[model samples]
Target chain A: MKPPVISAFEPPRRILMGPGPSDVYPQVLSAQAKPTVGHLDPLFIGMMDELKQLLQYAFQTRNEMTLAVSAPGSAGMETCFVNLLQPGDTVVVCRNGVFGERMRQNVERCGGQAVLVDNAWGEPVDPQKVEETLKTNPQARFLAFVHAETSTGALSDAATLCALARKYGCLSIVDAVTSLGGVELKVDEWGIDAIYSGSQKCLSCVPGLSPVSFSPAAVERIKQRTRPVQSWFLDQSLVMAYWGGGAKRSYHHTAPVNALYALHESLRVLAQEGLEQSWQRHQEMHQLLKQGLQALGLQFVVAEPYRLPQLNSIYIPSGVDDATVRQQLLRQYNLEIGAGLGDLAGKAWRIGLMGYGARRENIALCIKALEEVLA
Target chain B: MKPPVISAFEPPRRILMGPGPSDVYPQVLSAQAKPTVGHLDPLFIGMMDELKQLLQYAFQTRNEMTLAVSAPGSAGMETCFVNLLQPGDTVVVCRNGVFGERMRQNVERCGGQAVLVDNAWGEPVDPQKVEETLKTNPQARFLAFVHAETSTGALSDAATLCALARKYGCLSIVDAVTSLGGVELKVDEWGIDAIYSGSQKCLSCVPGLSPVSFSPAAVERIKQRTRPVQSWFLDQSLVMAYWGGGAKRSYHHTAPVNALYALHESLRVLAQEGLEQSWQRHQEMHQLLKQGLQALGLQFVVAEPYRLPQLNSIYIPSGVDDATVRQQLLRQYNLEIGAGLGDLAGKAWRIGLMGYGARRENIALCIKALEEVLA
Candidate 1:
């Protein structure tokens, strides 16, 4: 068979308002294009150090175990779960949306028993139910939950959940994939034992790397684990030897060099704006989108207080077809919005107001695009 | 503590002649700088189709399971192991160098017993030894080996190994991390059951993505597995839904969009040059490097036939400090070469002439740089 002749791939410029990969900053993209360097190059290692410090700022943590996982957010979630939970361990998993259910899968695949604390789709994980589950499963080693559920645009109270886990003498694993820069998450202050976030979502970076931080408590648990971490790629212990402090670093898996360059630029942008200010921008843009969406008679899936400002889930209008409207918007306006996933599929559309995508112009363009498509 | 203000990172221009991540083409780097798009965007998905076809050309395979994994090659290795091998299954793993040991780790982590068939570092796996091991462990479900061991620059007989696996009624999992684009590998003709390669090595793309292909037999094994794949992220079944055929793609994980762009361009460059030409160029450059290194009193670690032309592992001369020589090369000549890994560490240097890096000029420059540094 002859090889297919493929021309240079030139992707169309898009206005990404989807759940993730939300319009990476031009600087970040440019940074990504920087000349490739050896992963262990002195220059690259220096940049890695700065990248870690920048990640620390974005995660709002002073944890020494902070670094970007070489893979995506799903791998980051697995890293936390595989490192902390051993076989036959019991973990109280709060399932409110797609990511929470994914956490349960991680738990079960790691040979841990998942005692699910269920909540309505598009609702914050019920703190009361979590407490009860933890009380009943008193031997639970970990309490896992998604801080901001991207699928349903619901923001759970991570602070309260972490407190509950601490009170119950269990470590907490938090999925901050959608919450890192777009919401108020203080990994140190909120006492999150292990947290993972996507670089694409609210970090306005390319979609590959996952920034993760493990609190000292989480690190201690990993250290004490009797068995080796299941996934070698996601194993935090081995990875730390590469991303850990000090000038000399060990060879684990090859670090994603160019991607880290993009991440560093994104985190630097976040630091410049300040995490609190970035959060405010997301919230402000969400309000603008909310007013515009409300005018179109769209009802939000999650209640106002529990809603994630970065990911806004709204009901599909009565006569509008979900795919048709989204397709039309993409074709005509080059604007992309996420279709609902899992149980909310075809019933909702996710309009994102994430970092770099959270501009007034984007909000106006998305609303106008939807209006035109609907008409 | 306030976040440290970091300036834009400016990496020095260095001629990459390392074991992997050899000099990325200027066009590939430029492609990576293109505007970021949604991973599931129609345009991006269209690009993804072309990428799969391009990968098929590179791998010389028509297998429908060909796709670029979102993570690096290590994860790709894990993907093949976790998907095909169930608990208690025995795998005949050929341990010749660093990556072979990694394969054993993957097998053990997947709850499979790894029956080792050992060979010396810097030497290809002995096909007779592999056959003996397989005959002994008749229950072994798979035969795993690295086609090109990056640690010692030894090229194994993948065709012979695959044949041995087939003769024993076992699947073959081949690591082509350092072989793809640098050597002749006919995945279809050789009947490789599963294979994984890195973008960074001979593809001359960025380091993150892993291009993998599974034969129908391997896919069947994955489909027939009784237990769920241990990893949710690396599970090929879930990942296939996103990278598989058709216009519609399920959301598995956010792909490294920019990295894929780089891979597409690199593959396109490869196709234009043709695989045979790429391999010839590597061999030609290796010959040039060989003459130059011999003049400088350097000796190769591997014997003539088994040595990988792309990755030349040369013994460190007596009285020469390995790190000091490499550091001088980088500091003075702005050239990068790889230090030996695992058993070969401190005793050898891996000089690469991979995909875009395989040039007469690169060969000349690297040789000249090394000579000056040694002096």
Candidate 2:
């Protein structure tokens, strides 16, 4: 093969309305372009400490183990499972959508048994069913579930699930990938034992880092694990030495310095707009978008009470091709909306009003684009 | 705790002479600040294809399984191990410095037995010793070694070791993190089965992306794995579907869009400069820096032949505290040099001349700063 004669990649400025990788705040983008520094630099270490605190505020947790995973949300998800699950451990995994099934896969991959509590494609996870399963599986050590399923725009009750997990003597692990900054999530108050979310979602940061937190109980479980975490990279204990407090931080792997800068800026923006206010913005935007989509004669996949404000999944109208409309929106209007994943694929469309992307202007533009495309 | 009242982190420009995260090119930095786009966008996918080809050029490989890992170099290293090794597999590992030990750790984490060939730190891997180990361990399926030992500033005999591995009927996996662009690396020509590299090293890109390539033989081994790969995120097969060719791509995870743009820019710069020219330039800059360093009566860590042009380690001058001198350089001159790691910690200083940082100007400034600090 010959060498590629490629010029610099100049990506089109897309209005990202997809489930994730939502529109990055301009300051966050600029933060990434800031001059490079050593990962162990004093100022950088200071930035990391502040990043931990900011992540704590976002997760609403006082867990000292709160820090961003160097990889995406999947790796973050792996970090929770690998550290918490020893071989033969039983986990009550709630399978509501794509991410929950992913957790089941992770559980099995780690040699842990997953007793799945299944939910419909566009439905919230039932805590009553989860409690019954936990009661039956007396060996269950963890209750793993998605707080917000990006695939079907379903929002499960995290607080109720965590309470159920605690009642059954199981630690809770949450996949808050699309839920953290978009909805009402209180990790500490809700008694969440472990949690992971993506930077690309409601935080509107660059798409790499995964902001994860482990409670004292989760940390205790990790410390008492019989087998080492299968992944050295995703191993939380090793990562803690680097992200752990104090001026002297050991080198685990080089921290993605610039990406953290972007995260800090994004989280700073989140802090400036208080968490409650951000959630309200997403709710308001979802209401506006919902009204507009209804006017366009589209039907919602998820029930109104269980729907996520950030991610909205709507049924594909009869005779409208999935590829054609998404392609048109991409090429003609430079807009992106998620195609339904898993069972919802080809049948529904997922429109996001996530952080930085959640706004009146974006909603208006998306509605107009969809209306014209359908016409 | 009160929320962090931190402002946007405006990193002060420092002339980076640190091992890895060497000065990122200005264009690469600007590339990162470019507009956000969907990971599955046609434009972004096109860029991903170009990125694979560019990486192939960088590694001198035509391997179809070439793509960047979403995390840093450690994850890239883990990617190579977790995919290729199954439980009960024995790998003949060369232990010379920190990275080689890391290779052993990864193999053990994957439940594989590591048969180590010992070599002195700052010394290249002895091909004869590696060959002997390969012969003795009939169960050894893989030969793993670092091409360039970043911690010890030693450049090993990758071509010869790979040739030995091929002769011994073992697939070769190389740590090319520091060797990829600053030194000569021919993945295809050398018959290397697998290799993992860091974007931050010689490429001078933003950190967090690891460019990894696997030979057909290696991919074949992964395909025929007895058990599912422990870490789902690092599984090559799943990642391949997304980074693989054509219009119909599966979403494994969100690609770090802006980081890829920066890497593309960095690779474009490398391609424009040409690989051989980059090596020669690194050598030329190393010579310039060496003259000044030798004049100050500093002793090189690695002997003449094994010394890496991109990374230079020198013994700390007698009576000078390691932290004080490095801190003085940072605070006074706005220069950043690496502190020693592992066995070499507090005993030596590692100065880098990699990628954009490999220049006469940086060398001059580094030399002037060192002189003042020493005085």
Candidate 3:
């Protein structure tokens, strides 16, 4: 067979201000393209140590168990749920949008009961409602919620929720997939037990790696698991051996070396820019985007205080067609923005100002493109 | 915080003849380092479509549901088992090595009962035993086994196994992780239902992705699933949305774009080399390595006819310490060979000849190194 002649992969020059992945830095991309070192190589082990440190900084935790799960954000979610919860465990899941609902599904699949705290589609989880649910369901083992809900651009108060979980004697598993570098996630300060984040979101790395951290308490729970983690791949203890220190490491699945290189470079960039600066950059650009959308008579679906600055869920203009606008952006502007998901479908558009894409130029460009399309 | 400085990632030149991730091609590494585009970008969707087609060609199947799962080989195993087997489902699993035991665990985790057919650690799974197990457990929904047992460097007869599964009205879920590009796999011709392969093994891509294909029957099983797949990340139906056709792709988790780039390029290189040529290269190199090892008085752990040419499991030389030999190989020769796994540990050394690592030069070098160390 003639080698399937591929048209040279000439990626369009677009500012990726979508849900994810935000535009990766040139240095990070170059890092990804680097020669792959052996996963168990001594130099690679050093790199892993650096990566674990970077992840700890990004997640704002001193937890020694911080590492990148070798999969996407959803698999990161799976890693946390599968490792911590077991058959007959009761988890209080906050469902305001798509990711929260995903948590509910994960809980049920783990043979755990989900005591759902329902909220409106684009609204943040109400802590009072969660407290009431947790109090009523005293058996709840964990309080699971997305810190920055990607689908709806809603930001729940993670610290408050974690405190509530502690008050109820439940561990807190936070999903910071969208909030890792873009928002304030004080994992240690908040007393979060387990938290998972994505590389592609605010980190602006490539898409396959997910940075996860487990507090010592969460690690203790995993150590005390009655059942052998059902999924061999996501088992925390086995994974720790590969990522752990020492001359002799236990063998696990092959590590994604190149992806880790990219992630390491990305986290390096984050450290250089300063986490607070990155968060400020996201917020400022989001403000610029909000002003531009307002100039076009568009309104945000999420209320002011609770909305995630990185992901702005704005209502589609009355005369504008959602798919057509996205099509025009792709065809003419060569820009990619996300459409609203689930209940928000057709009614909203998710304009993301995340990481590298969280810039004045991208916001300005998106506004100009939207104006042309809406015209 | 000080910028997370990495001591420039310098990959030392090494001949990786181990179970996996065998030396990745320069082009594949470069591809992985490419700039990450958005997962849902038009350019990316085009790539995803191309990837699906490439996977179809690699698996030798016209199954529409062919794509890379965004995790390592173990997750690929979980995806197949969790999707195909529901609660109370009966599965006949053949356990000759570590990966086979993993399959049995997956079956049990999915609430499926596994009828295990056990064989010696360093031997191919006996088809007659599998047939007997299936006959005894006639209600088996699927027959699960490893095509390439990495732990033992043994290759089971996939064609015969699939035929037996068909005879018993059971679907076949084959672990082709180490066999896909290094050897021959005919998913359609052999009547396999679901198959999973790792990119790191012979595909010579980075480790994050698992290329998988599901036959129409397997797809049907998933569609008619009585209970939701226990894994939210590995759920095929939801995955299909992101990987599926034309203008209307579903919002799955963010893709690992750069890693997929590496996989697509690796597959492209495989196509360029011709699959038959790649398999031949592995075999020829294996022949050279086998002759050299035999000359050095090393004994093979597996029977010649049933051995996987890519992965050669040899008994550790008498009184030649396993740890010392492997460490010396790594430190001195910069060569990384695998230590024996599971029950075979301390007794065997698995030297691999796979993908870019499979060359007469590497074989000659490995033999020379082993001779010097053993002497």
Candidate 4:
């Protein structure tokens, strides 16, 4: 079998207003391409320490266990689950979107039972329903939900959810994949026990690394697990040995050196701009985008109060073919907006104003492009 | 909590001769820095198709299940195990070095029993011992071994081992993490049911992606499993839908778009160089390095017949501080060599000539640096 004669892939410079893989910060991309270094090099280890400090700030937690998982957000999600949920344990899982359903899958795969608190695709997880489920399932060891549901552009109330988990004596595991840099999340103040996020989302890095943080209580649970974590690669404890602040770090798996380099630069970019200010920018951009989308006659799937500012899920108009509009946007404008997933598939299109992608120019271009394409 | 005021990381260009993350090709690094794209973008999907085809060429197989795992080599190892090994299933695992032991760990974590076929750290798997073990453990459903022991510079007979597995009616799982592009490997011809390799190794790509291939038999085994794969993230069946050749790739997880770009470019580089030529280059470089090291009074860890050309593990001369020499080489010369792992720790040093790192200049620099540091 011969490899076909294929040319180098030169991706078009896209205006990415999609659910994620939002336009990367130029510095982050260039950082990854700078040079390759040995993962265990003293200088590289110094960089890893800085990376941990940055992750702690981004997650807003002083938890010593904060580090980026070497894989994507999905693996980060799995990391939290496999480390926390022992077999035969029950979890009160809130399912408002695709990520929530994924959480349920992680639970089942971990041999834990998922008692789902179902909500509409476009709505936030109802705290009352979650509390009721928690009351009913006293055996539940964990409460898991998505902070920002990228699938349907719904922003669930993570603070209230964490409080509910605390009240029920359950560890709070939050999926902050799309929420971290774009929303006001105080992991320490809110008492999030275990949290995971994506680099490509609000961090504006390439779509690979997942920044994750674990509170002391979450670490305690993991340490006390009788059975070993099923997936060795995603085992948080083993991973921590390499990413920890200590100088004498043991060899675990080979750290993804270049990806971590990119993450470091992206976090640096976020820090320079300030986290709250970044969140504010997303909100401001979202308001502008919302007005344009409204004037263009596209109805938003998520309600105003429950909406995620970074991810705006709008209805595909009555006659719009889902594929045609997305394809046209890609080919004609060199733009990319996400087609819907799960229940919202074919009915909604998600426009993102995430991290570095949250700019007035991007919003204006997106509106102009949509208006022209629709016309 | 605020992110520390850290300046941008500028990695020094070192000549990497480490056991695994050998010097990455500059084009591969620049390729990753290319503009970001949506995971489901038509152009990105086309690139993924090309990537799979190139992987097939590298592995010398026509397996439809050929694709890159989104994480590093460790996750790739887990993917092969969790998908194929069911609970209570038995596997005859040959442990020649660090990776083989990891295979045993994977088998155990998957709720399967691993029958050990232990070999010395610096030697290849003894086929006679493996056959005897298989004969004794008739219930052994799988045979797993490391094709190239990166830790000890031993290249096992994968073809002979795979043949033995076939004769015993057991599926063969090979860890080619260090062998892929630097040595001879034939997936279809050897009847290997499953294999995984790292990008950072001989492929000269950055250290995250792991290219994996599964024969029809392995795929069939996964489909027939009664127990769910322990990892939702590493589940090969679910992952296949995203990387499969079908035009409509369902969203399993957001593909690492930029990392895939790097992988495609690296694999393209391999294809253009021709697989056999790349292997021969590593062999030639190894002979040159051996001559230089022998002249420098260094001793090879593995015997000539069983040695791996890409990874050369040599004894650290007694009375020399292991850390001082390595540190000196790194600080003074900007050259990276590997510290021995596991059993060989403090006794051996692994110098790699892998993929893009297998050049005359690297060998020369490595020898000169070692001489200066040792003196």
Across residues A1-375, which tens digit of lDDT does each residue of candidate 2 receive?
A: 345688888788899999889999999999999999999899899899899889999998899999999989999999999999999999999998999999999999999999999999999999889988999999999999999999999999999999999998999999999998999999999999999999999999989989999999999999998787888888888989899946989989998999999999999999999899999999999999999999999999999999999999999999999999999999999999998899999999999999999999999999999999999
Candidate 1 residue-wise lDDT, A255-371, digit = tens: 888999999999899989988888898888899999999998789999998989999999997877889888888898889999999999999999888899999999999888877
What DockQ does each prediction reach against the true complex? 0.82, 0.78, 0.55, 0.85
Across all candidates, what is each one's fraction of true contacts kept?
0.77, 0.79, 0.58, 0.81
Write candidate 4's Cα lDDT for A53-136 as tens digits. 888889888999999999999999999999999989999999988999999999999889999999999999999999999999
Question: Candidate 3: lDDT of B53?
Answer: 75
> Taking chain A by itself, what TM-score does each prediction score?
0.99, 0.99, 0.98, 0.99
Ten residues in a row with the worst lDDT in model 3 chain A? A1-10
Best first by lDDT, ranked: 2, 4, 1, 3
Q: TM-score for the second chain in candidate 2?
A: 0.99
Query: Is candidate 1 or 2 superior in lDDT?
Result: 2
Off by over 4 Å in 1: none
Q: Which one wins by TM-score: 3 or 4?
A: 4
Model 3 ranges off by over 4 Å: A1-5, B1-8
Error of 3 at A1 (Å): 8.5
Off by over 4 Å in 2: none
**Per-residue lDDT of B204-311 in model 1, one digit per residue for the tens?**
998998999999999999999889999999899899899994687898899989999999999999999899988998888889989999999999999999989999
- Clashes in predicted model 1: 0
Q: Order of all candidates by DockQ, from best down to worst?
A: 4, 1, 2, 3
What does candidate 4 score on TM?
A: 0.99
